[model samples]
Target chain A: MKALLVAGEKSYLNEISYLLKDDQFRKSTKNMLLCYHSINKIIAKIPFRIYETFDCNEIGLFIGTSHGELETTKDFLKSIGIDKRARPFLFQHGLHNATLGFICQTLNHTGPAITVSNRFFSGEDAIDLAMDWLQLNKIKIAITVGYDSLPLGLENQVRGLYPQSTQLSTGSAAALVLANEEGVRKILNTNYSINLNNLFLERITYCRTSNARTGGSTSTHYYDSNAIEEIYNNLSRYPNHCSTMNLQKPNGTYSVINMAS
Target chain B: MIASTTPAVAVTGYGVVTPHGLGIDPLWSNLLKRQTCIANDTGTGIIDQDILEQLKYSLPKDDGESASCGREKSLLMALYAIQQSMLHAGWTSLNSDDGLIFATTTGYIASWENELLGFLSGSRREDSFQEAFRREPLGTMLADICNGLNFCGHNLLITTACSSSAQAIAIASDWIRLGKVKRCLVGGCETLSMLTSQGFDCFKLLTRELARPFDKKRSGINLAEGAAFICLENESTIVDRQRIQARILGGGIASDAYHMTAPHPEGLGIYNAMKIALNDASIDKSEIDFIHAHGTGSYHNDLSEGLAIQRLFGEHSPPVYSTKPIHGHTLAACGVIESIICIKTLTEQILPTNIGLKDRDEKLKINLPLEHESVALKKPIKFILKSSLGFGGSNAAIVLGGIS
Candidate 1:
């Protein structure tokens, strides 16, 4: 299928806009989502990864999934009274690779669509791998979906790994459609970057019991503590070198309240 | 070698552990004989009766908890696989400078899942979770395996869904080529957990019998659990005595960006992944002699995978076989272990038959290997494409060719 990257989840956009309404972003919208999210975050959870990597308005081909997505397609389609017979259409797009399928289906185009995950780097890896799909010319359009949600299981698993930190934050990711076009998301013009170094980020632990005991009244999001962006920023700059960055969190769940697009 | 940055991965060795087959030989034999391990559950010793009763819908109440096995079997299988692979590659030892990329969708999840259910039921306390919640986790357990085996290296966990192990292979290959690690033990491991079986049961997708992929009468998948690892090296990295099983030439991953639980109705993602692999290896589709399809055997899965095959190779998809019929679905271990089979098949030219294709789907027009067939390539082939699709929309295709 043509590498058609069209749209991505809107949750992160909502979060980004919510963040944009904040004071820090009002003065300099220069980087917009970049300021809020990392190149990885913006590209990964949103349409940023494939935004500039592919020709958006051409041959339709998309690839992505909303990991435990907040806005589930099943419920949405079902609410609208979508045909059970047409449900495969719903299932097709709902597949973790559905982001790509929808791009193809909506673009009124028929092409290959693939969805894969290495858990966290799915968006990044998908973009890199998708770029390699083209033979004769740039794929018509490649939509890359890099969205994430808090599966209760993943939260507990990651929490067990990093227990000093508690609470789960669900994220909605998006990115624009792309093809053999151009964009400025990349430092070097490429769809995605592969970081294979065994960089061990230090335990930038924030310990507080009150935070765990309290609920929404003291909710904290990944964006609030800026841990997510901090992670990418530190990792990207240092490559394989580990860095420990600390930030405090008030009591509450790491809400997906305000973040990058 | 000025840091070959391209994605040319090599598999020096591989290991496996499963109920049907304890290691490669046993697993292989089971695959050949179609000996399924799915049956009435016996005590796996991981759960208790109360929780079992709570999860009533799931059959084999005494059966395999295949879904979460990534967390369960990964450690043991990883150590086993890493040990064998290292021995095969002749790297009897390693120091701290090496690296690791262990992949799994759910690492230590079976433990965590069960304990969490206990926690919710108030039977377990937070303090009891100390071991399960450790930082190293199952992934770190792999690092420990490296250290125990005297392979010193960096350890990183790659957690993609079903494509996890394949991604581990791809990523490790890239690292070796980049001169990051002289060698890396890359693989995915997982184990059966109560939660997984229950979850599948909740979805009403669990098959009580051994899974039958591509079979017309196949009901659903029979989840199994296990681990597999490979010692991957570069041309000049290090030498070991273990047989050089396979060299990873090319592989690609595609995103359907579609639904969370189904492949594209048209099998588009599968096609893209296939095209990427062929282009990556610069091999023609016509050259493929065998295809180890990610045929989970669920009606939907087979149908989607079949359509994908048609879309990519068009009518003549290579002689195809799905090992799930034999070993059941090994989740994270599926790719690595299956790749080992592909590598073995390529080396010996012995393609094991699909053990469980009882009733064939008329719509599935591809040639299904129902019996062991001599590898009938024009010559000792250079490439075999393996495909995998995950629970959510995840698909990975990797190509392995002759080591020579």
Candidate 2:
């Protein structure tokens, strides 16, 4: 089975504040704000008539994050020590899945929803799970999102840990709307290629190496919150040829995603 | 929906570390007696320090100096449960193709809180900074277990609030059914910390008294700490069928899309979850013998879940019970721990009662076992349904069938 990336959106730290000006985003928590805004942007990019034809129950949402809601957790914890009381709102929103709830509620999606974390590979993991659901016929369309926000102090600490790494500083979010073959033919029509761009329908295969040392040392080290978007950009640049991206961690473990046209 | 031709996933062995005691024997016995392990003063179920110390000494010493260092309580509890499960499965080591999935709502929060508080209080600032730099990613826990057990297949950490482990189990079952992996070890571990306690307290969701699910005057929930693991294998992979405890028929997950902290008032999402689960199992509602409800004792949670059960089973509803009052609510680990209870129930043909139910809430209109009224079925219990609902409107249900 193949998954076609139909729509996508992304947001960085500077653009996030502007995206939160909408009324729908006013009530969202800090982490939820980042994800909701990016998803909202994706929805806005799709044609309204086509989006209306999709069934909410057939849409699945998968989110990946390293330290979910770290700012809210820190704030809530500090409040307990200083004020001798915890803020209920912050506490409720600090959960890793809280962002899933907010996005599902806004979209009225009732299909399978989950949050997965594997450190730097979280983004790839989310996309892989979405593809699995599509291949297993569990859902017609899958919204895969990768989001993370690092507070200033924590960012410095992480930087000190990996001085060679440059992608661990800012907060960012990216989302993609993927559709199976049947969903694409039914919802967008077989002649629907005229409207969408960068519609790469490709087969995905995942392989993991325990000892990166034996893998000939060609692995790319990318650990940003928008790692999925980065991979997409690289693959899209070489659309005429089959390409592979290997995401490696400091440890010897790494995941290789082979995308074939 | 799952086709009948889909491969069956079997539960080969399971283990747990809860406040009642280590292993499943103590928990099963206490549950049969309808006893609550919630401490009187703390109003929470906490594992004894003696048991923890015993577990610490029991760790495998082959990992060198790193094994003796101060490990997080969650990791220690998970290791103990995993060790017991692997031993019960009669495997000295895991295959390179075997997988491991860990679930947790709060990962290493207690340690993070300690370091942050020390830094904020102007004490041990330099040490706290250094510790933060040395902190490993949450996936490191899963990697640690895999390296120790020689498991090299897929590994994932799921954190979807209270239903975390249930979803993990569902995903593992899918992996087995789809031929992605032959065997998978799935479990969850949670440690009681000030973050969860004070956080729930702020919402007035924490109870000062014992939790009373389905009771008319039920208070809130008691926060607890625990860990549980279940080893799942493809039916074809099992050489000795006698080791099979139960067969995982099917599972389903759904979202309410309703609220962040509160469930849908009418339990629409939960009803969908249960209905989907039955369909996935390719069985009718009449086939289920009982339900293991996610009864957190909170007014909204109990009422919503009860209403959902009534809607689904509709007058012929089988017996329903919650073991939360016994283990108090273990958060992310509740799903797996309660599932172990369900497995034991199926194998032993004994149905445990709800521990603290006094006056049933007439509004629910669902059948619930009375306090101290555990029952041993005359006929064999064939199918059991387990349900879990979480903070983010995440609902999950799985069907487990007794090995015939």
Candidate 3:
């Protein structure tokens, strides 16, 4: 409907099961919403969004990453006046593929939301997987979500790769609404390859920041100062290299490369 | 049965970032001198002093620069390892559509969490991974290494604890063997994490000093961090020029159906893993020259692993050693790292001594390379077995062979 799909030649979701439908790859809905309280919460929240209200043909596809987050939608369930299961369905659906199950629970799309990941590119690869399926005319709409709550390993590897995105050590969540379009923002037709040489690193330069939602930098030097020269010249290497390296080691010092501006 | 015998996959290259050191030069050099790549970091990921103040033993930190810190922000190592492996696999000389299979248990979670925390706490500014794959999502870790690398294949993330990387390699090998992929770059990455330190500490499963595995005095494990990758190809495409490290005989996966954290205690799942692996390779347990066991210096695991080996090998169990104490438990990286180590041992014809195993545990009478003694094998050993058992009773064992 909105996003046109393009795909690489080879992908798991490309092959068709029958001449009629396409196969989309996902993170898995194996344990979608394990209990009933979460189901009550879902039932309660059913009124707010247009997704839940509609009969569901226009928006051809809907995908969600995980079902549960910090707040188990507990209050909403109580408001709906429903009983919680012995084991919270919120927690069960709270596992990885709960959201997709939620969509499936509501909208009757006969297609499948296949879960998959190798690490890192679950989101993009999931999109690619869906696009490959689309090329095979798997489905018309594609919604992809790449989100993770704090897992056991998240805290340690942060100092090295993603030193900027963590907020209270919470997991990252990303979802994109995509559709197989003949004349739209093509999701397919792009040559996707994982190259070691093409790794991208983001550099942030603060611009006259005032308190928005979250506050500004505490470490003054790289604060909201209006000077690009300081960072461009690399005039001073990072001052706090404390949490950068071997961050996994117990008390391994974070390096100066942290909070890099 | 899921894997093809005499796999078409060729291990083109390997990359390692561990306390044993990062890069091939340091790792190989340390191997020759028989030195250990262990060190201390006092920076930030873990407040060693603070934890020591609270917990009995000091916790490991993210020291990306220290030998013990080999697995942090060093994207160059990943690049270098890939380059070196490609060169060795003759991949550099030729161009092929081999996919890169990057794996990690703690894949950049440490770096990502702290930075995001700093941002959320109103301490720092910048939205890296969030910004990178705004439309999509990225890393399981705090840092977005996966997006950073820009992988576009059937990118996979296998996080079954210690078996993470090995499973990645196995799948990559399968992709090539099954012709699902041409060539595959397979490996794993893990950095130290304070949370992991606290989690392990909470579980009371660490040693005060450096780890001492397989020793009567072995207390607990020293959790290390890092990454390692090996390039693999189809044998039909590769000529038998370079001496093989160890043939990847067979690999098998089976769930314990037991516990979330503990092994079956009876070693049921692990036993089947080894047996299935041997059978898949069309080899017998007796043919195994040596075994690289996942001897994390824990009470239940060592005994369980010992039982599994005894059950499989009976009286003729080959020499086995766990390098955990030597290079702390590298978590997910261990699968590929240990496999590479097995390759190194097979190619060099040496069964490395278990670094800290001075004395053996009384109840466990399994063969361990406890000392720095080299065995002069008259001929090249064919099969090398490497096993990795993760939490949730997930067991995976891989057999590597084709030694000439």
DockQ of each: 0.11, 0.64, 0.05
- lDDT (Cα, tens digit) per residue for candidate 3, span B108-178: 44554444444444564555544322211223331233333433344455555666676666556656655
The sequence of per-residue lDDT tens digits that candidate 1 reaches over residues B1-404 is 11235545567777666665445777777666666566646312121233233223221222233322232334445555566666666776665656676766545555554454454455767667545545223334543454455443445554446776776676566566555566777777766654345445545567766567878788787777767777777755435524567788776656554555656776666677777777766778888877889888678778888888877777777878887766667776788878888888877776777766767788877777554444455666567899987654556788889766
Ten contiguous residues with the weakest lDDT in model 1 chain A: A252-261
Worst-scoring 10-residue span by lDDT in model 2 chain B: B63-72
DockQ of 3: 0.05
Q: Which should have the higher lDDT, number 1 or number 2?
A: 2
TM-score of each: 0.65, 0.94, 0.58
**Regions more than 4 Å wrong, model 2:** A21-24, A48-51, A189-225, A250-253, B64-66, B372-378
- Best to worst by DockQ, what's the order? 2, 1, 3
> True contacts preserved, each candidate?
0.10, 0.73, 0.06
lDDT of 3 by residue, A1-261 (tens): 113311111111112222113132232222222111222233333222224322222232222232122123222222122332222343323222234434443433323333334232233344444444343233444444443333232223332333354232233233333344431222222332311111111211111112233322222222101111111112124332222211111112111111221
Q: Give the Cα error of residue B153 in candidate 3, in Å.
A: 3.2
Give the chain B TM-score achieved by candidate 1.
Answer: 0.83
lDDT of 2 by residue, A1-261 (tens): 568777777766667676567676775765677787778887777763333666655778999987777667767877898666678877877777878888788778777899988776788778877887787777878888988777644666555555464446367787888888766766666344435444444544445555553322221333434556665565446554555565555444555656555
DockQ of 1: 0.11
Alpha-carbon shift of residue B240 in model 1 (angstroms):
7.7
